[model samples]
Target: MRHSLRFKVALVFSALTIVLLVAQALGVKTFAEAQEEKLITALIRDDIANVMQGYRANPALLPPFDARLNGYVSAADQPLAALPGSIRNLSEGTHEIVLDDREIHVAVVPFEARRLYRVYNFSVYEKQFRHVIDMLMAGTGIFALLTIWLAYGLSGLLVRQVAGLARQVKALRLGGSTPINPGKYDEVELVGLVEAFNDYHRRMADMIEREKEFTCNVSHELRTPLTTIKTSCELLEQDAAQGTKSRARIQQIERAADNMRELVNALLLLAREESTQNVEPVRLARMIETALAPFADRLANKGVETVIDMDRNVHVAANRSALAIVLSNLADNASRHTDRGHLRFSYADGWLRIEDTGSGISAHALPHVFDRFYQASPEQTAGHGVGIGLAIVKKICDRYGWPVELESEPGRGTRVSLRLPAAGPGSASPDALSAVS
Candidate 1:
């Protein structure tokens, strides 16, 4: 279904060549036929003129006769009964008639009291002409075939450099510093294109190196403080005389630290082009609970109900940390948007789905919901967290080869689904519905 440039070029050349060659052959055939007719007419006219001059000078002279040419004299009032039946009724100045399968040219001229008929038989010449035309047609056909072959070869030569360039581009790597050698190309335009591509490749390599360094530095600086905060919270939680409120605050701090750590890890994972994490079987129910832990108070404060509709024994084969990050982001988005009603999490047939009855995304914003840093309308921007949560989920899903889909409608609700690589042996049943309010 896909056509390459070489094939298109060759087809165009072949078509044009055939059209021009056919046109030239037809023109030559037509011109040759016209010239032959003119020569025959001139010879007949000359013979008639000589016979008329001789008869005028001496009334007793007879018209000439030959194998190809003949002259007949008949009185203007007399019927041409002695002449051939095919040319007897002709009254024109010059006419062509066929007699017994032979072609004849007749020129009728009026003299003092008689009509002169100059009849020339050119059937042999006509046969020869037909043979020449047949030969010409055969030559044209052979030349057309040769032209098609030549056109294909020339087109291949024309596209050879471009094909080589494409191969070189495909072989290029992202982190490579070596450039395509411009000297390999002969055309100035091709050399310029090669130079431009080389420049772009170098710029991209430098940009990627800078981004890698930045992510490394930021990761180190942020994790150090996050670790200190988590350790201090653990130390404080161990105090014997700490009040209930104080203990709750310490736990909140610990949870926040944990969330920040997961966010950092997720961002780092997204920054790299490849993942090195080992795949393992992750308990689906436990991972969902962990992702929703931080949003428990928020959902409760909003008077929103929570429903988990998946079998407890269900597990998925994936990178644990990556799955955690994806689930956390989905939970965060659902919790942030839902003010009332219920948020549901369910898994079936290797698909994990999160549905929320909240202020759903509008039709205009739905398409761009997964774009990095894409904010919704002004009213929805509050507490949306710069719109990278879904972007992170999308990136992680792509990295793990999981298919993710989102559906939303304004004033209705939103649903996000992710198809995991593999699911454990289990099924959803009525007993699996666990409601928490």
Candidate 2:
């Protein structure tokens, strides 16, 4: 599993806090232990000194003593009896002794006349040390929790700027028109990155604008010559001998000119960075027939029949010119490959589908057919094209927010569909029911 940057930062902060808290607790415990040991040693020595001095001044006064302290004295003939075994061999210094299943802190002082010993219960001081340790642990734990909370909060604050920047970048991808506003950022790297992105975005938009202008100029320039050629072909057809081969060739020239004109118009439509779609109710059946008119002769020459199955009352909201180009290209492509079998067009449930029993695309190539300039293997069939027709269809559909789908199988057939918005009541006319082929 991958962890987010914010989560990793918080974890690191918590770990560092815990380590510092533990170190602090240990230091406090060590200092407390050292101080307690020093005080215990001083208490043992002071108690023994007082007892020895009091015994010299008056032995009776030393008979009674505090419960926490005990002492023993020895003369030259009388050695201290019943003293703990640990104290018997003890040197003239403080020592811890275990007696009667209890620990004792004792200080032994050697004197010329007698040996004096002062003793204390070690468990009493041990209990105090335990209390101090408990307090240290409790304090450290509470502080550690607070430190973690603080670290988490600080990390959130630190990541907010980055999160905001990421959101802006996402907005740009989703067709946001406004330029990115590189606001103030405390981090140097973030500031630099924002600046770089802004610069890159500006250059990219400029390049696209230049490309569109170039395409528009080229298409616009070529259309004039295409129009002249189409006019010349029309005049020649009228004067040529009827049923002559020259007349057929003249028709072919006219068809080529018409195709070029449609291509130019489609290119211009695609070149526009943004377009205002003039939505109106369009007669779907009539539109299909009008688009197929240009390719009818070609379909007849190929011995392929065309079929249209639709309701004349079916109307859709669309841009007429763009829709015409889309349908024309689709019909032309279907007719080109289909040498024998009929091409079918069906409309229902706001969708128009074109199915062709033609040279179907290979499985691998099918997915990429809509990409610009992508062509299948020539050996597959003569229908292998220049590869811009379907791409232009896709571009127009995307502009209008229409959903387009294509499906094909090798040696079987291909189906292309378009889902459009339905028009309201009384939108279609009776004349929309004409046959396209």
Best by lDDT: 1
What is the C-alpha lDDT profile of model 1 across 1-437, one tens digit per residue?
Answer: 98888889988998898898889889999999999989988887787778778878997775533222133543222232345644545675988876556666668877654556765667777899989998998998999999889888998999899999988887786334568899999999999999999999889888988999999999999999999999999999998889999999899889889888988877787787547575666678888998999999999999999999998767688777688899998999899889999999999988988999999988888889999988766466675688888888888888888899999987788999899856445633222344311
Worst 10 residues of 1 by lDDT: 428-437
Q: TM-score for each prediction?
A: 0.81, 0.60
Candidate-wise lDDT, in order: 0.81, 0.77
> What lDDT tens digits, residue by residue, belong to model 2 across residues 150-219?
8888888988888888889899878775766766677888889999998888888889889987987897
Clashing pairs in model 2, backbone N/Cα/C closer than 3 A: none
Q: What residue runs in model 1 are displaced by over 4 Å at the alpha carbon?
A: 53-89, 99-102, 111-114, 174-176, 239-243, 275-279, 371-377, 380-384, 398-401, 423-437
TM-score of 2: 0.60
Clashes of 2: 0
